[model samples]
Target chain A: MSGRPLRTFAVLGFATTHTALAAEQLLRDLGVPVTPIPAPASIGNGLCGIALRLEPGDVERADTLLERAELRVAARGDIEDV
Target chain B: MPASSSPRPVAYLDHGATSWPKPEQVVHAVTRALTDLGGNPGRGAYAMALAASRAIFESRRTCAELLGVPDSSDLIFQPSCTAGCNLMLKGTLKPGDRVVVGSMEHNAVARPLEHLARTGIEVVVVQGDRTGLVDPDDVEREVRAAPTRAVVCQHASNLTGTIQLIGDLADIAHEHGALMLVDGAQGAGHVDVDIGVLGVDAYATSGHKGMLGPQGVGLLYLSPDLDVRTQVEGGTGGGGSESPDMPIERPDRYEAGTANTPGIVGLGAGAAFLIAEGARQHRRETELVYQLIEGISQIEGFRVLGPPAGAPRVPIVSAVHERLEADRIAFALDRTYGIAARAGLHCAPWAHRTIGTVDCGAVRLGVGWGNTSEHIGLALRALREIVTS
Candidate 1:
């Protein structure tokens, strides 16, 4: 985790009317360390301000969990270390 | 048309409007013109001017090939689709004549007709089905209802990506002794358009959109049989007497003032690129659109607009969720993810009214040659997140 920068992946799909609430709910349900990340310019993953960041090592687990919850993963990328 | 060799992973899905990231060869051609042949095309008699003239001539020839017209001189270059439409509409129609337009026409066609409608000319609008399909029979009926001077319609609905049957409509218009004008804003480069085969009276198109060239360039194709009045009068570089009257010629009469030489030259390169890449590949691109429609339709709350699946359509899809506002959804997708899409009326109020999506307007996703299956899938996933959330 120290060597690898924190990676970001956009859970693609409609953030319908309840996107923020749903995002909060999903984060809580997964109980995995996650945070809201600003939409990345390099990856045009979403049109809104709701992207998710996770520790690089936990991305795979996050993807599986989101998929099981019937969410489409829009884009996956490594968070560039500034 | 500037050259950039380094490849990036950006998925360009807007070719129905204009091709993005034009081919390297088009860029090279544009570069060559800017560096070498920078003189005014038809004004001067110098070598550089001749070279510029050759570039313009070559562009006209390439446009001829694209539209399947035999004579390159029959085509005239204007600034944009609107200018081409103005030239054709203003040049041809008199005050007392009747003009019939389709409901799904872009403003380029609609505005001119609306302006003319203020005059004594009668403007009749032929409505399309809810799916954006215009019936040739309806067009025929409209033309027959009155003495129609010209029947103007778009070859494809830019908002919905619905391809109109221009040939059938042309025959219908011709039967009623009316000329047909096609706004090929969305159809020219994305689909196969054979002016010879269609036998349309006039075809107006933008160079920037679909043709994959820079803006301020458009092409107008006139049939040999139709005699159009000149919209404006000016020099055309042929040593005609400096008369205040318009030139008594086909293209020279129509094309007035200095032409967009660089834009037209780039358009030629763009057309050449289309020909070399095989323009038929657009059908394959539309298949991706079908896939998107199919995938999105399976989602419970999502509703896709435009022509039905498997219908003869271009690679454009408009859809929205039952619970989400189209603009909100579009904003969410753009802000939360990086999906670049267009939403709202898409500049065709008549089309939106016809489709009953005028209130919210549909979220439009246009796929181009540059888009891939992966991009579609990614878009679908993003849509699902926005909808289900």
Candidate 2:
């Protein structure tokens, strides 16, 4: 468990066409880590607008943050440390 | 269809359906089979024909070993899992016989059993839990209700990647004097399957899927004690006779027409690769799956489907946002993010109904041997972005 910092991503559930802008603001206000990585063209995990990078130990805290923001979190997972 | 106007780099994650970017060895074996061993297998005693026959025999032997079946000749190669399933269903069941199948079966097994149902075969569907795990007792109850001729279940669900308890179900089938047929379309190469220990009478598998082979090749394993009659007939090289019927031999009796020699050769090489990789692949895949499940469960309003954490399941996972249609999410993932995943019914409507995903289906991510840790991370990041937007 005490290895490299685990890069994690987070999804904020499905956003309405109208509320999408508000959702982005909400994600930022919640202090969710944002990464500017390009999406791969062949995987189908659930995501909408924002992605977060976190240590593996911080995943539970990230969940709590999203819940406090009233954002519906969808999925989170570790990425290769890049 | 024309090639893409502007090609973009994509990470393939649909290995449970069919592997993309096949290993070089698989391609080379297929090429060599077509160029060097391009003679009818088991038809002639010439050098080329003998080589072709050897290739076919070796492929069967490899498949038998992978499935943990002792007798190599008991394995028969067919065009696909659908054909193998049809042969097993039609050849084994008589009119008025009863069959028990899991609610999570693919169309290959479901459609054939449904077709047989019209012809006097009674089909009973055993329900699975919301996570797609079926209780062995439920299957046992179904079998005990009547004289069940066969019990059909999938080793892993293509939709949810939920692994079934085949050994327990097989024991129940045996106790009730019924044969068990397992659809291993999503199981074979992605996970380790021991047909002998599972006690299944027949195990049908697709080569193009988890096996990482070319299309048009599949395998069907029959237990030594199960007396499954042949449903198809054609020339099988030996036992020359004027009658145009199936041969009395083992594989020849079931394998009708000329074989896909190249595809089978490729399949053999793919199986060899899996063996070389060893069982560590399963551990790696399961680790990825656990990481994925743990990550996704934290997402509010994002209900994950299939088995819970610590469940014995494959790397395949399905989830959907409460407010989004599964297909809509799938289309966006592919079109905007370049993430390839399967959506909709996944060819098992009964499973969808059982899991309450019939209306919008489920967003399915089936990881393969070729997938890397970076690929999983990238997928998760993209999914978060898509859902948030």
Candidate 3:
């Protein structure tokens, strides 16, 4: 469900360290580049204390990539302030 | 072995009471929430408040994933498992409705039912086996004999370490058109609590005990179909502060005040640890439990409660000496050897009664991921010293 932007950052997603590492590998194979960050203390620190940081406009594409790789985003939201 | 030799190093075997020495991440998450995210969740329009609200939602999602609940919104946050049980019991049942509960239920579930009984609800206590395990067929018979509205059972006995068959019991309750309300206080983190597979209607559990979270937070899971009345009413931050009516939303309807943001934040981190390494941690605790139980069994004049050995159970072990009082032995262990343990009725008199220790509550030892053979050896040595002295 699409809603108004909720956060100040572009977009954020929570996942395990294993999943995050695997996602990085798969993204490299698919010629996609993305950087993951340690989730803000307010949100969560995922398993490795990191989450995939996405551009505000890239939320749609990132969702597609995650789906293609069969990895579920535990939580995701735009970091941009509404 | 005198005081000059120095008391043995502390052996904390009271995880069943409240896990100590929590994972570093739990403590860090708590500190981070307190220091950096100092905003009241769902209370204001500022970015700080929204961030706090977002944190809570994320924590709720993590808890839902761990319990295998399909919807995160259905899992409400409460102050403790006791409060969650109260909410479920008071929310779901009405006066004159009948409920069947296992004999070994802790006060979290039993007290609420008792309170409901005073309000005209009919609460029947079904007998558990000598091992403190409830018989599903017997519970089913109770549901069949009467028009039961619900069946309250705990996932595991805190005192006896017996693990109940919740899925089969849920099936029986469903067959009788009754709701299955489970007290997962001792069950959530230790065992496989997939709600779909277990088929329970509602499950409530503590944060600190099994999830390694702080003490102020717990979770309540309600099946999508079930409806429960709210117990408290106040501000819901639902944008209608003028009206006194509670919001009709799921969590907002149940939680009416400022949320436990820091505790829930810690829960998110701790439960994530359990979810990531649950199998490994379970194996660690299991191996430690077997070692602890085996060592305790070797002590003279000591007897562990429940089945002979190798019974399906949690990591808790309870014992009582032939001559010494349970509390006395517990005190001796602490005073003479720096070992920490719990010895009492453990707040579940029925459990002690079911295990034939109503007169003398058993000394309970709960092994956990932090415990090792060295702790067990120290505890056993202390027990030996007490018996000999």
As for model 3, its CA RMSD to the true structure in angstroms is: 8.1
- Please list the C-alpha lDDT of all candidates, in the order they appear: 0.74, 0.74, 0.80
- True-contact fraction in model 1 equals 0.00
lDDT, residue A40, candidate 3: 44
Per-residue CA lDDT of candidate 3, range A1-82, in tens?
9897576554344333334444555565676665655444344322223455655666667668878877566555544443
Scored against the true structure, residue A49 in model 3 reaches a CA lDDT of 33
Candidate 1 or 3, higher DockQ?
A: 3
Candidate 3 per-residue lDDT, tens place, B203-259, comes to 999998888899999999988788989898876554234445664546666887778
Estimate, for each residue in B341-363, the C-alpha lDDT of model 2 and write its tens digit. Answer: 88888888988898999988888
lDDT of 1 by residue, B294-323 (tens): 998998888888888998787788886788
Off by over 4 Å in 1: A1-82, B1-9
Give me the chain B TM-score of candidate 1.
0.94
User: A55 in model 3: Cα distance from truth in Å?
Assistant: 16
Taken in order, the candidates have interface RMSDs of 27.8, 28.5, 14.0
Best by DockQ: 3
lDDT of 2 by residue, A1-80 (tens): 57777554432222111122223344456665543222211122323222334455655665676577554433344455
Q: What is the TM-score of chain A alone in each candidate?
A: 0.63, 0.46, 0.63
Report how far off residue B26 is in candidate 1 (Å).
Answer: 1.6
